[model samples]
Target: MVDPSQAGMVAVGAGLAVGLAGIGAGLGEQAIGAAAVGAMAEDEKFFGKGLLMTVIPESIVIFGLVVSLILLFVF
Candidate 1:
């Protein structure tokens, strides 16, 4: 069997990976969703800004992916 500490670390790492990834997705969706709502409430012209803002969360996911990769390699 695997070492308990090692297994615990793995679990922690996985939790971090998933949690961070979800956070990233949530962050990404938050702005975009907000913008969408604003646009819907305001003018159609806001569509472009909303779209741009929505995609802005992609960076967080990218960072999370990098962290995950690093963890995978190290672990």
Candidate 2:
């Protein structure tokens, strides 16, 4: 049986894992998205590369979610 106190701490840790990861991803996406927009403005051909770069930061959020789920379920 899980102790109530320990369960609460685990919940907090899981929340923090996902929250901090999301924040980091958002920051990264902000910078990448700006650069992508600028590059796209300069040349239409840059759209593909810019889009790819902008999307890469989204993986960070996915990773964070996986970690959070592991923490929540695996202790």
Candidate 3:
């Protein structure tokens, strides 16, 4: 059986992990997205690469979600 205090701590840790990751990803994407848009505006050919670059930061959120799941269920 999990101790109540320990469980609470673990939950908080998991929440922080996901929340911080999301915030970081959002900040990264904000800059990348703006740059991508600017590049796309300058050259239509930049659309594909710019889109890929802008989407890359979203992987951080997925990683964070995995970590949170592990903490919640594996600990």
Candidate 4:
């Protein structure tokens, strides 16, 4: 009992949510990753902090995927 137009719109929205989030995550990570590498290059002890910072942006993608999944099932 799903309307085709509604379903298509939901699908498009889900795709956009996931794709844009992924792109944003990638861009966010790129800057952080560069800075992390630079810091690590300057000091060996910065590795742990750098790694943690580098990974933090990955949560954006996870959130986007969760939203996309919810949209896929909820609608």
Candidate 5:
């Protein structure tokens, strides 16, 4: 029911929100994975902590996905 201009703007906003979030998540995970690998390589005892830290990025991704979905449905 939206006019073409408004609809386009909304779609653009949705795409930006989701796309930027995804990029952030990807960067976060890459950093964590690298750190985990580095830590594990240096010391085996770091396994637990490294794993926890690495997986922490998953929450960022989940949050982004949730926000994207909410935006899609709510708007």
Candidate 6:
């Protein structure tokens, strides 16, 4: 059986991993989204590139999820 303290620590770790990564991703996306919007406003042709750039920060959340899963199931 898992010790209560260990389980709590693991839970905290998982939460932190996801929470911090999400915050980081949000910050990154904010800047990229602003730039993307500006570029799109300047040129409609920039829409695709803008969208791609904005979505790039989403990978950070994905990585965080993976780490959380690992902490929950593998530790």
Question: Which of candidates 2 and 3 reaches a greater TM-score?
Answer: 3
- Would you list the C-alpha lDDT of every candidate in the order shown? 0.74, 0.89, 0.95, 0.92, 0.78, 0.93
lDDT by residue for model 6 over 11-46, one digit each (tens)?
Answer: 999999999999999999999999999999999999
Residue by residue across 1-75, what tens digits does model 2's lDDT show?
457779988898889988998999899999999999999899999999999998898898899889988888887
lDDT, model 3, position 57 = 93
Q: Taking the tens digit of each residue's C-alpha lDDT, what string does model 1 give over 6-49?
A: 87786678669867787878976976797698786888787777
lDDT of 2: 0.89
Q: Give the TM-score of candidate 4.
A: 0.93
Q: Write the per-residue lDDT of candidate 4 for residues 21-54, one digit (tens) a residue.
A: 9999999999999999999999989999999998
Q: What lDDT score goes with residue 6 in model 1?
A: 87
Q: Can you write out model 5's per-residue Cα lDDT over 1-75, one digit (the tens) per residue?
A: 556568767677777777787788789889888989998999999999988987776777677667766666676
Using Cα atoms with residue i matched to residue i, what is each candidate's TM-score against the true structure? 0.63, 0.92, 0.94, 0.93, 0.70, 0.93
Q: After superposition, how far is residue 23 of candidate 3 from its true place, in Å?
A: 0.3
RMSD of each: 3.6, 1.2, 1.1, 1.2, 2.3, 1.3
Colliding pairs, model 3: none
Worst 10 residues of 1 by lDDT: 1-10
Task: State the weakest 10-residue window (summed lDDT) of model 5.
Answer: 1-10
Which scores better on lDDT, 4 or 5?
4
Best by lDDT: 3
Model 5 segments more than 4 A misplaced: 1-5
Task: Report clash pairs, candidate 2.
Answer: none
What TM-score quantifies how close candidate 2 is to the native fold? 0.92
Give the per-residue lDDT digits (tens) of candidate 3, residues 1-75: 568779999999999999999999999999999999999999999999999999899999999999999999988
Clash count per candidate: 0, 0, 0, 0, 0, 0
Clashing residue pairs in candidate 4 are: none
